[model samples]
Target: MKDIITNIIFWVVGAIVLTVEFTFKFNDTLGWLLTTIGVILIGIGFIYKSKKPFKYLIEFFINFF
Candidate 1:
């Protein structure tokens, strides 16, 4: 119950922040923080959901640089 309440609070705060962010000029700190979190979450999702995610990640880095 406590965890669920905490999660709801976090979601509400996140939504309010996003609304404020969109209403005003872009915020660099918020942008980077959200982007980094999004990227990491997506990476983790891909790794756990895909059968050959590591191979793709390695290939991407090798081709990137």
Candidate 2:
């Protein structure tokens, strides 16, 4: 399913971005950039009606912010 694949991609990307942000102790600008992108991808996944993964991502995003 296209939706499944898309959500998976977004989920993976978001996870990677957040991981890099936390692991590197980089500048705030880079941190914010990654955070913003991760949030946007998760938000798009929600908009596109991704199911369980999206639900979990939404919960993570909520707690993340």
Candidate 3:
């Protein structure tokens, strides 16, 4: 149940980020911020089973940098 809820939240956040990205014209810094967040959420969703979302989140940070 907890995993399900976590995945749902991640999906919702990712969806919102994508919608905002498409619906508005943000400046480069804000755009990169949103994109980074969206990607982190997605990557976390993909690797949530091992309690390693933080690891995946850091991976996203590395990639974005």
Candidate 4:
């Protein structure tokens, strides 16, 4: 149940990102960056059993934003 929720969340987020990337006339660099980050997130979720290390990226993004 938890895994299903996790994958769903990842998929939804990825889809939203791709939609934004394709819909906007924004920076190509930023679009590719979003796609890469989304792929990395899906990879990490598939490859790992735990979600502990995500805090690092989350914190980084928080600071980045």
Among all candidates shown, the one with the greatest lDDT: 3
> Which residue ranges in model 2 land beyond 4 Å of their true spot?
49-65
lDDT of each: 0.60, 0.74, 0.78, 0.68
Residue 17 miss distance in model 4 (angstroms): 0.8
- Expressed as tens digits, the lDDT of each residue in 13-46 for candidate 3 is 9878967986895878998898888878866666
How would you encode candidate 1's per-residue C-alpha lDDT over 5-55 as one tens digit per residue?
554555455566555556664668887676555455445543544458789
* Model 1 Cα shift for residue 36 (angstroms): 1.5
Q: In candidate 2, what are the lDDT values of residues 1-65, reduced to their tens digit?
A: 88778767876787787787789867878878988887787666555554565667678779999
Question: How much does each candidate deviate from the true structure in C-alpha RMSD?
Answer: 8.7, 4.7, 5.5, 8.9
* All candidates in order of lDDT, best leading: 3, 2, 4, 1
TM-score of 2: 0.62
Off by over 4 Å in 3: 50-65
Error of 3 at 65 (Å): 26
Q: Give the alpha carbon lDDT tens digit for every residue of 1-65 in model 4.
A: 88767866776776677777678835778978987877776655543445565775577579989
Where is model 4 more than 4 Å wrong at Cα?
Answer: 44-65
Candidate with better lDDT, 2 vs 4: 2
* Model 1, C-alpha of 37: deviation from truth (Å): 1.5
Best by TM-score: 3
Candidate 2 lDDT score at position 52: 68
